[model samples]
Target chain A: MARLSDVIEKFIKSLLEESEGELELQRNELADYFECAPSQINYVLATRFSVSHGYYIESRRGGGGYIRIVCLDVDKNNFLHYLVSEGIGSRITEHDALHIVQRLLEQNYIAPKSAGLIKSAITDKAIGIPSTLKDTIRANILKSMITAVMAWQGK
Target chain B: MARLSDVIEKFIKSLLEESEGELELQRNELADYFECAPSQINYVLATRFSVSHGYYIESRRGGGGYIRIVCLDVDKNNFLHYLVSEGIGSRITEHDALHIVQRLLEQNYIAPKSAGLIKSAITDKAIGIPSTLKDTIRANILKSMITAVMAWQGK
Candidate 1:
């Protein structure tokens, strides 16, 4: 027999997938369905799901209160499609660009060496004077190169 | 006479300048060296140096515990180049993309008009794409424009 927490976790994930937007679940009701403590739901959420793990969770206190979870999907095909439309225009910040690169790496969308090369290329201070525009330019170049790679991968 | 606090501050700054990586120290030992209250060290760290001010401080209480401080040298230029080579291979957000442009403007690298043009081009309203590809294209275009600008600047 499967553990109650595992069952609850799967059940909640399924609900989140089925829902179009945010997923809201009542702790008590979920506990009743699983015949476990209300805190068990909390345990499953805290352990199996976290923001760092690509999940957003919110909860309210008091009667009829519920927990809301948002899933951050990083599917490779979907990411590629998304990249194609958001044409890199001119400027992008270092932090924001870094986040995108990190996300792609985490999702295995790009190889480690490729990611390192990208990081080093943009960081080469010899490219331009240190300024905000440099970050933007770096972001644009990264987006363009990555999109080209993705397009190539589709072949 | 130079105050003990002044002496300590100078000592720490010199240590930072000479040291590689983070600097570690003990509050009680430092207090004994200066012949002051342990809280005095805390006061100096809290007031003069902070992580937000480009310094990182970490400490622990109890036996044989110590404090560690790291000066963060955020190389905006290097980070930008790294983004170009690594980050642009995919999609990015308009907000993040704008941040890079803004940073470039602050650094006096790109003209303000160019930044504005790039921003308007990459926005969701501009792209009109429900998919995430908008971010990727936005990153790519930004990179190309920057590279062109850098090449021009070099000439």
Candidate 2:
């Protein structure tokens, strides 16, 4: 049997396909259709539709309120600029670095195995330096890395 | 990833730093801090703190005897050879490769910007392949990159 989460994901994806990649769903109705709790619907939306996964969600509450989800287009040029300029400061946490790698994977800007390599390369443990200096060093490293990746892409 | 042995090794090393490159501790005290069996400490000492990683451990087991740890200076040539042979295998994950790079950076083998460029170029994503194939390619790439780095240093 398909897992409840999997089924829910597939159903929503099917809906998205029909709706041209944007959707506004009735929260309660989705729960009723899946025969699951409203929180389960919320869970699905939270995990599967995050910005890092190339989604934009805006939810409204009360009567006539809806859950809005948009399949965001991957803007590599804009993203590369942000990553180099403001996205990475002097030091980036491993979690945030991995998040960006995940985002790149979701957008097809980078491959999955490459994502794993990038994650490993940026970690505190990998850097093997004092905690205070890691982030600043990480920032410089990531900026140069992103620029290099862009140049490799002939951008 | 944070194995008990690895955690124990890090804790001991942290204490060594504060103690000016050497430390003495009760096995039971460390076991108590990590809430693991006392034997776990011995396991970590026997494995991770071996001479190859540039650590030395001595213990006199008894009521008053303490385990002592010391950080050893690395022999760059020997360390580099070990990294190429054992630290990286036919498949080098980004973690292992990056660890080597970080060590090189710390040892002044590569400059900070050069390290970043090296990381970007050697990543599996830059190579673009299936996960199963990536490690093999990464190993080849890392070895070549390291050789290039060494050559650059000599030049």
Candidate 3:
């Protein structure tokens, strides 16, 4: 059987697809439906629905609280430009970088080969340095590369 | 004044260009012409004309011997495969990796953007781990990325 997290991720994706890439739901209700803890729902959202994964998430607190998820819809050229300018900060973990690459792949902004190259470049195995400075360097390099490819559209 | 090494490199490249990418000359004579030691000639050849730099050098000893330089000529599809199989070994330094990326760009096997991405990935800044294991991991990642793009020809 698939892991609970995987199942939850799929269910949320289906809902987003059906709803045209935007959806709102009650966290407690989703937890109840999945028969999992509220924390579990949070875990899925945090891991599988982050902005780096081409998703924007918003939530409110109190009795009327709801979770809003928005699949990124942007001009293809601006997508990478936005990420370079705002999304990737000075430091980023391998996980977040991979998510960005996956998002690019899914959005058809890059080919499979390009995605493979990007993944190979960003992985911890390739970026083997001191832990303290690794994330910063990774972000810098990733931004530089993305910027290099930004001019590739319509050509 | 240009550095002696740079001047020598430029001179040799011109000669190669004129000769259609192959040259034969007496090492000692060239060293004398440059007013440098035979070792300097050797240094230039070792650094600037390495196989990773898309060059091959063969030197012979004794009075009748001459140095032979051959620029790599191969089908573009076979180039990366050849490197993955025989060129990049278990370990490679940042300098060598950069050289390989440069060669690929020069040969037009990859676009400038792709080259930028590859260079960013293989740099020490990106691969910031322990000293001992850095090169090995760098080699692995470079080969993997190259292999990923090998099938991209004519597509």
Candidate 4:
């Protein structure tokens, strides 16, 4: 079964596709239509429609406040640069990492095989250390790797 | 069509691939998934993934215990080295892998450029995959990258 968030994400994306990657709607109305609370819409937006996911959003609260979503036409190379330099912090959650890779894969920035290799190298078990030390290493490793590839491709 | 044992082996291997070189499972549940007797899972585990195949297995029979599988570190250059050859798999932790790269650098086998390349290429953040799939891809990249470097050196 599809998660409610997933369904909402798909529904929102469908709307964006028709509207040239931009959509404006009332959050309460969207929640009512989906038979969910307005908070649900907020949750979906926060997690799924983040900047890392190539989305930009602005929501005005109170009556007549419309939530506007702008799907950025960001290129993979530029996105990759942001990911290495600013997006990734000292320690990253598995979920965030997966999101970035998925975007890269969808945009054809990286080969599927290369994507897989990236995942294997960053597991908690693979790092085999205390939590405090893991994140620092992950950041260093990820940054260097992304930069190396960019250089290789002359990007 | 594959034999029952072959099917079992493949299924387990598939799980291992997603897991990046290790897996822990309930034998009974696995047997149920395969629609075979519990003995079938045991037999496959014993025969197909023996110590000779570069695997380590440990199992406990009581409740809440699990069958633990660790892909040993087997050095590609020195097949007997536990940290390299047997240690890397479909998934690798950041720490263990960094250790290997550090060793390579100390040994002067890989230049700083190549080591940096290796780290970036393997971060889960860089790969951006679901946890299940990250490790396998990581292993593949590391192995291919290492082999490619070795080949370059030889020529």
Index of the highest-lDDT prediction: 3
TM-score (C-alpha) between model 2 and the true structure: 0.50
Native contacts retained, all candidates in order:
0.00, 0.06, 0.46, 0.20
Q: What is the TM-score of chain A alone in each candidate?
A: 0.52, 0.77, 0.76, 0.79
On TM-score, the candidate that comes out on top is: 3
Per-model DockQ against the true two-chain complex: 0.03, 0.06, 0.18, 0.14
Tell me, by DockQ, which candidate is best. Answer: 3
| lDDT winner, 1 or 3 | 3
What TM-score goes with each of the models?
Answer: 0.34, 0.50, 0.55, 0.53
What TM-score would chain B receive for each of the candidates shown? 0.48, 0.47, 0.53, 0.50
lDDT of 3 by residue, A54-148 (tens): 78999899989999999988777777888889889888998889888888888888877778678766766555555656687668768866876
- Where is model 4 more than 4 Å wrong at Cα? A89-95, A106-108, A152-155, B1-155
Which ten contiguous residues of candidate 2 chain B have the minimum total lDDT? B146-155
Model 4: share of native contacts present?
0.20
In candidate 3 chain A, what residue range of length 10 has the lowest lDDT sum? A125-134
DockQ for model 4 equals 0.14
lDDT of each: 0.63, 0.68, 0.79, 0.68
Comparing 2 with 3 on DockQ, the higher-scoring candidate is: 3
Candidate 2, residues A53-77, lDDT tens digits: the string is 6788998999999999899886798
